[model samples]
Target: MQNTIFITGASTGLGKAAAKLFQSKGWQVIATMRNPEKENELNKLENVVVLPLDVSDSVQIDQIVKNVTNKYSVDVVLNNAGYGLIGALEALTDEQISRQLQTNLMGVIRISKAFTPHFREKRKGLFLNITSTFGLIGFPTCSVYSATKFAVDGFSESLASELAQFGIEVKVIAPGGMQTDFAVRSMEVGSHEAYEKLTAEVSKGYSPEKLANYTKVEDVAKIVYEAATDNKKQLRYVAGSDAIALYDERLKLGAEAQVANIKSMFTF
Candidate 1:
């Protein structure tokens, strides 16, 4: 039987790309998104199944987990359903902050739990969590987004250690900015005229193309595949030019110095 990969947020961007890539590599794909009605391309592919999933909805998650586990075998679960909340800290509302954590952090936790029983029973499984460079290095504008991703990083690290004996491998994929709806459709911008200039400056630094940034959806998918298949017992797989540089620099200079170095590059 072919290995199956269950992916979240597969309607577009890295999720969509991974669904297509894995299918080409002979893996059955359970491509899930918030709105399957919006998906057309993924459904056309053979051995690909598109399902509706909103990570923030726990009931739906429970149902999907039950259905998929009973019907088909899943070798890997890619938690790639998340969006960025951009703009000034003052612009962020309490509800927005809660939703950000709920969707990005809580969602991952709940879904992983739903799949844990199955993986534990089999004594083997893989979890590829999609984090970001911001998760590693703190920046100016992405306070909440960074918090959620950073939480994922810590969660993956601890979970990998905890589940090491269970024959389950939990890893993180931290891709820098990529060319996708992530910057537009997947992100929500806050409004605060006072921070408009600051947001613009911060936004410029995040652009995947500008200043030789790192944000290619295809490249991200390739890295995602590598993280899923690689057997080196690696923990974190980072993609993109700028994101790689950030990861490297963090290793060289410590946290404080790394943040300072990044801020020095952008104009205030």
Candidate 2:
């Protein structure tokens, strides 16, 4: 039987790329998004089914899992539905902060929980989570966003140990910035007069020239494929050149030095 991958946030960006890539490789792709009706491309692909899934909604997650597991034999569940919440803590509203946690952190947890039983019963499956380079390190404007990703990074590590006995594997794909609509569409930036200078500095990193240097969405999707099929005990796969450079520096400089280095990059 051909393998299958259940992906979240399949409407665009990396999720869409992964859906197309996996479908081309002969795997059944269960591409879930908030608005499946709006999707124009992936639905037409062979062996690819686009379903509606709002990961933050627990009831919806349970229903989707029940329906999909009943029909398709999912070999991998890719928890890739998330958005960036960027701002100094004071600049962010409670609603934005809560929503970020709901979608990015709670959403992944709920989806994974819903599929755990199916994977356990099957005796083999992969839980591939898309985190971020910020998950591995801290940043100024990305405080809450980094928190969500970092939580997932730690959650995946613990869940990996818990699920090992059940023949289930949990892996994390931590990619750096990508040249995708995420910056425009999937990111929310809060504003505060007090932090204007700091926000401006952070915004510089997202400029056209800087973003052009980021990794391609398609390339990171390939790493997602590797983590699914590599059959190794690896827990984290850092994708992209920028991500690799930052991660390597972290290793060389150690945690304390890395923090100081990041701090030195910004000024008040």
Candidate 3:
């Protein structure tokens, strides 16, 4: 029998890539996006079902999970729906803050909660959460975004212990910058004149040379597949060379020294 994976934010980028990869691997893919009508490719693939989901909406989340679980035995759930909220915190609006928190943090929590009963009853399942390198190490412009990812990281870590008794595995996929439209389409920048120098210094880190080394969406998707099927007790899979290097540096330097190291990169 073939297994099924339910993915959120599957219309584009890493989510879309993962859906395709899993489908190619002979697994059924339930690809959920905010607008399934706008999706053109995944809908046409065999063993792939495009469903509508706005992870921020609790009602939609519960209903969709119920409908999918009833019809298909979902073996994995991928929480890949989130966007970046960059720039100065002071420049960010209350609406932006709320949206980031709702979609990035709460969305993951709610989705995990919705599927907990099913996984618990079946006594086996996997949850692959798409966090970020920012989730592991703090950055200048990613305060809010980092907070959300960090919370998810911690949440997954704690939840893993509790769910292990039921054979439910919670894993976090933390990737660095990827060659995606994330910067162009999936990010919201809050600009404020007072913080121009800080944001500018931060912007310099995204040099062309650095971006050229960013990992491909498909590559990260492969890592997701590995984490899903590796059947190891590993709780975190850091994808992308940049992500691995940075995280390794953090681990080697220790927290305070790592913060100072990152701080030394920018002068504002």
Candidate 4:
């Protein structure tokens, strides 16, 4: 039987690419976003249903779960509905911080909780989270965003261990950067004048600006397919060539050296 996958944030970016890729592969896709009206293109695809789901809204999440369960036995749940809130920690407001956590961290928690019962009953499922390379290493001007991703990383790690015996796998994808509207729409900048220098430094490291950056939406989609379809799942998949290379470099450098190198790169 073709597996069914439910993806959050399917309106654009990697989610959009994954939806198209999976649909081409003949899998049933329940592509959800904040607005159903905005999904005309995705809805026109075969075996793809564009549902209304605002991951930050609990009511919407519960309703989508019920609708999905009634219509299909979803085999994989991709928690990809998140945005970046870039700012110095001191300049960030409580509301801004809360919004970041709500959409990135708590949203994942809510979706996972709603689907856990279904996975438990079937005893087979996968939860894939789209994190970032920043989750592994912190950087300036993206501290809050990194914090949320760190939460995702820790959550996926702990949940993977907890759900292993139950046949549920939790995996995280840490992509360095990609050519997507994520940089244009998903990033939140702060009002700290002191952050100007830091912001410039951060901009240089953006995945889109990097030379021959290997993190593409389709590339991440393929990795998502592997995580969903492969019997032996990996805990995390780095989705960018630069990320993989940098990860290796970090590993070789010892902890102290890695920290020093990162600090020098960011001038932090």
Give per-model TM-scores. Answer: 0.95, 0.99, 0.98, 0.94
**Model 1 lDDT-worst window of ten:** 205-214
Give the candidates in order of lDDT, highest first: 2, 3, 1, 4
Q: Of models 1 and 2, which has the larger lDDT?
A: 2
Find the candidate with the highest TM-score and give its number. 2
As for TM-score, the candidate ahead, 1 or 2, is 2
Residue 71 of model 2: what lDDT?
97
**Steric clash pairs (candidate 2):** none
Cα-based lDDT at residue 10, candidate 2: 95
Q: Give the 10-residue window scoring lowest on summed lDDT in candidate 2.
A: 259-268
lDDT of 1 by residue, 17-96 (tens): 99999999999999999989978799999999999999999999999999999998789999999999976789999999
The lDDT, on a scale of 0 to 1, for candidate 4 is 0.86
Question: Candidate 2, residue 150: CA error in Å?
Answer: 0.4
lDDT of 1 at 137: 87
The list of candidate 1 runs beyond 4 A from truth reads 206-213, 263-268
Provide the clashing-pair count of each candidate structure: 4, 0, 0, 0
